[model samples]
Target: MNLNELRDRAYKTACDHGFHDEELSNEHCLCLVISELMEAVEADRKGRFAKVPVDKKDTIFDERTFHYQNKYFAENFEAYIKDCVEDELADAAIRLLDLCGLRKIDIEDFTEEMLYGAEESCNDETFTESVYAISTIPIRYEYEYDYPLGGQLNSMLLAIFGLAKHLDIDLIWHINQKMRYNDLRENKHGKKY
Candidate 1:
């Protein structure tokens, strides 16, 4: 998945949906990313994951849109596939990518750099610990003096991709589904923030 393209799409979608109506502080953007990571941690603790049953995998994508709009699907399949650990990770990635797009960072390069080494580096850290570490990486952009925010964000993206790999998540698929869902939602997703 070309990350820069996804970044562009994510940011554009956010702007179109009114998230960009006013200037957003970097802290606020990273806070949203951290929020998604926190949700992932909760999903892990609760044993939630986006595991499409083997029998359903073949047809899930074919009927993706139908299920996305269905109340039953929203309650059941949504819990299984949309509010799971992997999906939350995808949300975290999308949030970061949107930030990168807003700042015009070249995330595709960072994504390519991290692709092969992802599953190899995070073996020593538990999933929750690693996620916590990733969450911390983005905050440095707000407080540290003279550190390039793009580079710090790229580092966080590396950690996020590593977690995604360790979990065997098809993040691109989840991100696509999420982008569609985001497009259909109310402004600021009905949140005051």
Candidate 2:
């Protein structure tokens, strides 16, 4: 499936998991996405990959659980560490997609623009300009004018895409895996960090 299709699926999955039932504001959604990005950074620093922890039984299944070490290593340690980064990045994209779906944004267009912008940013010598260029996306007030997070969603997506490219990760595949894992969670991955 394409990115847009994935966005729709992620949103639907989140809804099925009760993300929309809680009346979350745009700020809450943005904060959740930011939290996921922070988790990605933490995962990269600590080398914890895969959702299952070494001491699975002891985990509280809350936001703090991402720091736990994984005992279920089926491959090289380096690959596992990379996978942790991939998974966290995927979570970031998934949360952004969920927000786009909730707010009825044209993420396909936004994604296309982001891709072009990213390609352009690749040639630039400075990182700050690239960041500024990617973070700027026009906001529409059609569907939910009162929501503030809608404006920042594109920036989040651009950041995730940039991070994924830097890490040499296939975001779509990781997103699919994360979504599947989310589906099987006890409460739609609600207990997960």
Candidate 1 — worst ten consecutive residues by lDDT sum?
A: 53-62
Instruction: Evaluate model 2: give its lDDT.
Output: 0.60
Task: Specify the highest-TM-score model's number.
Answer: 1
Q: What is the lDDT of residue 171 in candidate 1?
A: 75
With a 3 Å backbone cut-off (N, CA, C), the pairs that clash in candidate 1 are none
Q: Model 2: which ten-residue window has the lowest total lDDT? A: 68-77
All candidates: CA RMSD in angstroms?
A: 3.0, 9.2
Q: Whole-model lDDT, candidate 1? A: 0.79
Deviation in Å, model 1, residue 190 alpha carbon: 0.7
Q: What's the C-alpha lDDT at position 144 in model 1?
A: 67
Q: Kindly list the per-residue Cα lDDT of model 2 for residues 93-171, writing each as its tens digit.
A: 8988988888887654545567556554556434334333333332333243543455557555765676556545566
Q: Write the per-residue lDDT of candidate 1 for residues 71-97, one digit (tens) a residue.
A: 554455465577788788888988888
